[model samples]
Target: MGDNNSAQYVGIDEVPSPRAVGINKVSLLPLVFLIFYEVSGGPFGVEDSVKAAGPLLALLGFLVFPFIWSVPEALITAEMGTMFPENGGYVVWVSSALGPYWGFQQGWMKWLSGVIDNALYPVLFLDYLKSGIPDLADGFPRIAAVLVLTAVLTYMNYRGMTIVGWVAVLLGVFSILPFVVMGLVSIPKLEPSRWMVVDLHDVDWNLYLNTLFWNLNYWDSISTLAGEVHNPKKTLPKALLYALIMVVLGYFLPLLAGTGAVPLQRDLWSDGYFSDIAKILGGVWLRWWVQAAAAMSNMGMFVAEMSSDSFQLLGMAERGMLPEFFAKRSRYGTPLVGILFSASGVLLLSWMSFQEIVAAENFLYCFGMILEFIAFIQLRMKHPAASRPYKIPLGTAGSILMCIPPTALICVVLALSSFKVFVVSMIAVIIGLVLQPCLKHIEKKRYMKFSTSSDLPDIDHITNEGTLLG
Candidate 1:
C-alpha cells in the first residue's frame, strides 16, 4: 500500500503546477446517488423477487435489507471517506489495514466488475432504445452499443475529470428525473397490503436465496473511491444518505409504481412496463419519450462507471500492483491504457444477452459484498487511530450489531439462490485466489525487498539509502 502518511505538500518549489489532479466538488452526491439509484437494483429484476419470493422476500429486501445493509454500508463509507479520502476507496483502506494482496483483490474485483459490466450497459441501452420495437439487443446492434459506450466514455475519461464531471451531472439528471416522474405517478395506485406478501414459504430455499442475491450485492464502487473525494469525511456520508434517499425516489418508486400499475413481475421484463408508469398516470403520449429517457438513463450509468473504473485501475497501477502500462495516461490524466483493457472485457461480454449478464453479476455481487463488509470491519480494528471525521456512530459494538442483519440476510440469500450462478461466482473467486500467488510474486519483483526495520524508514533515510524520492 502507498503511504497514507505521505506528506500533503503544495507550492512552487514544494510541488509542481497547482492544478486539480484529483476529485472536486461538482455535486458528486447527485452522480453518486445515480450510481446506486438509477441502475443496478431496479431494472435488474429486483421486483421479481418481491413477486416471486412472495411479499415476504420482497419486504425483507426492499424494506428490511435497506435498513440493514444499505444504511450502514453508506454510513461506514461516509466515515472512512472523510477520514482517508485518497484515490482508490476501499482498496486503499484494505491495503492500509491488511496489505497489498488483499487490497489488490478488492481493486481487481472492482475494476473487473466494471469491465465485465460494460457489456451489459449498451445492451440495456439498446433494449430501452428499442422498447417500442423488438430484438434490438440481439447480435450486431448489441455489439455496436457496447462499442459506442466504450468508445465515448473511454474518450471522455481520457480527456479529463472536468469533462467527466459535467457528463455525470447531465447523466444523473437525465436518468433520474424521468424515472421519478414515472414512479411518483404510480405511487397512489399501490396496495399497501401488497408489501406484506410472503411468497417464498413453500418455494425452494436455495431458489429463494439465489433470487435475493440479485439485490443484496454491489455497494462498494463509489464507497471504494471514498479517499478521492473532497471532504470525504463529510461529503461521502452525506452522499451515501442522499443516494439512499434518491434511490427510493428515483428508482424504487418506479418499480413500486410500475408493479402496482401492472401487478406483475415476470411480465415487466418483456413490456418494460416500468417506463410506462408515467404514461399510465400522467401522460399517455409520453410513452415513446420515456422509452428514450430510460435508454439515456442506462447510457449515463455506463459512462459514470467507465470514468470511475478508469481511475480505479490507474490508482492500482501506481501502487505497483498492476502493470506499469496501466499507469500510462493522457495529457488529461486519464488512464487510457487501463480503460482500453477494461473496455476489451466489456466488448467480449457484450455479445451475451442482458439476462445472462445480470445472472452472472447477481452471483459475483454477493461475493464482492462479503469482501466489502469484511474490509470495513478490518479497517476499524487495524487502523484504529486513522482520522475518521464521519464514522458510523455504532463503534465496535455497533459495527458488530450492524453486521449481523446484513450477514444473516446474505447467508440466507446465498443458501437460497440458483446453484449454477453461485457455483460460477465461486469458481471466479477461486480463479482469483489461485492467481494471487503469481500476483504477489510479480509484486515482489517490483519492490524486491521486504521490510527490515521496526518502523517504516523515514523519507530522508530512504533517500540516503537510495530508495524512493520524497
Candidate 2:
C-alpha cells in the first residue's frame, strides 16, 4: 500500500503508451456512440416505462434516475478505469482493493449479466419486424431469426472495435433521426396535459423501476474496452459525459413526443409502440422509418454489448482470473474465445421473455455493482494518494455519501424481483463462487494455462511516493 501522507501522484505521462501499429484505437466520436449503444439503444425498449407508470412518472424517472444511478456509476468508472488503464477494468480494481477471489466473482456475475443483457437485442429486433412480417411472431421462424441476427452481429464484433465503433456511429444516427422528425411533426398535435397523467396507486413499481434501471445503467460497460481506446484517461471521461447527455435526451424527447401526441392507452404502450406513434402522428412512411430504425438500433446494441462482454473476458484472462485461452485475440485484435462464449450465452438465453430477461439480468447486475461500490470506497480509503487521471472530485467521506443513493436503489431493485428470478440469479451467483475455486484447483494441477500478462503493472506494489513500482 502506498503512504497516505505522500503528496505526489503518478502523472498521465506514466500511463501505458498506445498500442503498436496494425491496431486501430477507438477515438472520441466512436467511443461516445459505443457507449450510447451500450446503455440506451435509442429508446427502443423504453416504451415500457410509460406502460408501467404514467407519462409523468416515466419522465421524472429518466430525469431523476441519472442523479441517483448513472452519474455515480460513471464517475466511479472514470476514476477507476483511468487509474488502472488496462483491459480487466473493474476486475483489476476489485482485486487491487479487495482480493483476486472477489475479483473473479465480480467478473463472473458481470459477464453473465452482460450476456443476458445482450440476449434482449435480438428479441427486440424481431419484435419491431414482426409487426411488418406477421409470420415472425413465434415458432421456428423467430428462433431462426434470432440465430441469424446473432451470427451476423457476432461477426461484426469479431471484425474489430474500430469497425464496430464506426458502425455504431451510423446506426446511432439512423436510429435517432426518425425520433427527431417525429418530435418535430408531433408539435401541432401535442397535448401538454398528457405529459402530466399519473396514477400513483396503479403504478407497477416492479416494472417501472426495472425498466428505468435497465435503460440508464451500464455506463461502466465502456471501461472493459479502456485498453482499446486511444488515450483512455482523457477520452473515457469525455465520452461518458457526452453519451450521458445523448442518452437522456434520446429517451426523454422520443417519450415526450409519443406520449403527448397519442392518447393515453397504457395497454398499447409496449416494445414497438413508438412505431405506432409515428404512424399516428405523421404517416406510414414515418412508421416504417421508425421500425427500420428500431431494428438497426438493436443490431447496434448487440455488437456494442458483445464487444464489451467479450473484451471483459479477455481482460479477466490477461489478469489471470481465467485460463490463458480466453486472452487469445483474433487476427483483427478481437477476443476470439471470449466472443464465442458470449455469443453462445446469448443464444441460450434468447428464449426467455423480455420481462424475465430484464429482471434476471438486473438482479445479477445489482450484485456485481455492490462489489464495485465496495471496491471504489475501499480504494479511496486505503490508497488516498494513488494516481487518478480523472478523479471524482470527492474526499473519502464525500465518496461514501455519493454511493449511498445508488446502493439504496440497488436494494430496492433486488427486493422487487420475482421469486423465480431471485432463485435463478442466486443459483448463478453460487456457481461463480464455486467456479472460482475450481479454476484455482485446475491452475494448481496444470490442467489449463493461467498467467497474468507481463505488461500489466503490479497492483500490490505502490511505492511510498505514490508511483506503481515495477
Q: List CA RMSD, all candidates.
A: 6.4, 3.0
- Candidate 2 lDDT tens digits, 3-71: 121236654334453332468999999999999999998999998999999899999999999989999
lDDT of 1: 0.57
Number of the predicted model whose lDDT against the real structure is largest: 2
Let me know the TM-score candidate 1 reaches against the reference structure.
0.79
The sequence of per-residue lDDT tens digits that candidate 1 reaches over residues 165-199 is 56666666665566666666666677766554454
Computed on alpha carbons, the lDDT of every model, listed in order, comes to 0.57, 0.90
Return the lDDT, model 1, position 252. Answer: 49
Each candidate's number of clashing pairs is 17, 0
lDDT of 1 at 453: 18
Off-target runs (Cα >4 Å) in candidate 1 are 1-47, 54-60, 183-198, 201-217, 224-228, 263-271, 276-284, 443-470
